[model samples]
Target: MIDIPDSDRQLIDQAIFLPMLLTVLQRDLAAIDKGSFKLKQPYQISIEAIIRDVQKDLAAAKRYLHKNNIKIIRGRSENNFTFYMVMYKGGEEKRSYFNDKIRNNVEDLLDYYLVGRQEER
Candidate 1:
């Protein structure tokens, strides 16, 4: 097993999950814009705010990865698992995740960024 520093692992995770979260939020924003909600403005505003925050975090993660000579590439998915290839420094590691687990994780991140973080402010 390749030992990866916790901080690098976290940045890598953000690199993977943040984009997914942003994509989901963008889709939700589009739905809110088109849906016949009586008060769509609030929902749209909330989602837009979250989107901006996620984009900032994503950009930071990308910058860190580049600066540290790290690369993450999505690999083929099989059955219930999705694979990722992480290359850092001179070492490479392959990681696999269950598809449903990925969805659940991204959902958790979305909730944190959208509601939990906002509550802290």
Candidate 2:
């Protein structure tokens, strides 16, 4: 079984999850480009522009490693399966769930926009 320390989980979330989110945004942008032919005139440009801005933000996140610089180390098990661990700087090397709170906030924003949940009036 693969086990990740809590500290590493935060770094993993940044190094892996941000890129995954960017990939999703890119896919959405591609679909928008492909389907623009059917979108109404007034909404097409605005929607594409918004998506482009989000892509930019994700790109920025990928580059913002000035403090908690992250790296992944890999090792081979006796059975030959490769395992990876995340390492980072600028914090204690202990398990803490504080990053989970931050991740939840980010997820809430994503759910609000991408998942389109609405509040009752």
Candidate 3:
């Protein structure tokens, strides 16, 4: 199991939740792009919806971070392992914090939510 600080779980949760959420959206968008079943517009529409919803999720996450007395740095997912950018900070130096558990847990969630979902394979 991965080890991480409890204090950082909030941050980790932010990281994990959004990516997992987005990946599922991306998969649906990909299917839409493929014109697999429905009209070609769903892929584009789903992606657009996901993008808009991401803003909402980020806002909720930002508020959650504030309520927990932690500063939040926002990042946009860019399809890289290091996809997120620094948006803000609260109490500690960004370098002073790290969480592999959160990372692995996020990977697990993404895999489950993305690859393990129903697909037309």
C-alpha lDDT values of all predictions: 0.94, 0.50, 0.53
Worst 10 residues of 1 by lDDT: 111-120
Model 2 lDDT on a 0 to 1 scale: 0.50
Superior by lDDT: candidate 1 or candidate 2: 1
Task: Encode model 3's per-residue lDDT on 2-121: one tens digit a residue.
Answer: 233565565656654676557766776776777667567755864665456565666777676666555434444333333223333423333222345446665665464334532523
Provide the RMSD of all predictions against the true structure, rounded to 1 decimal: 0.9, 8.3, 7.9
Residue 89 in model 3: lDDT: 40
For lDDT, the strongest prediction is: 1
Write candidate 1's Cα lDDT for 72-104 as tens digits.
Answer: 999999999999999988899999999999999
lDDT of 3 at 104: 68
What's the lDDT of the predicted structure labeled candidate 3?
0.53
Off by over 4 Å in 1: none
TM, every model = 0.96, 0.42, 0.38
RMSD of 2: 8.3
Candidate number that wins on TM-score, 1 or 3: 1
Error of 3 at 108 (Å): 6.0
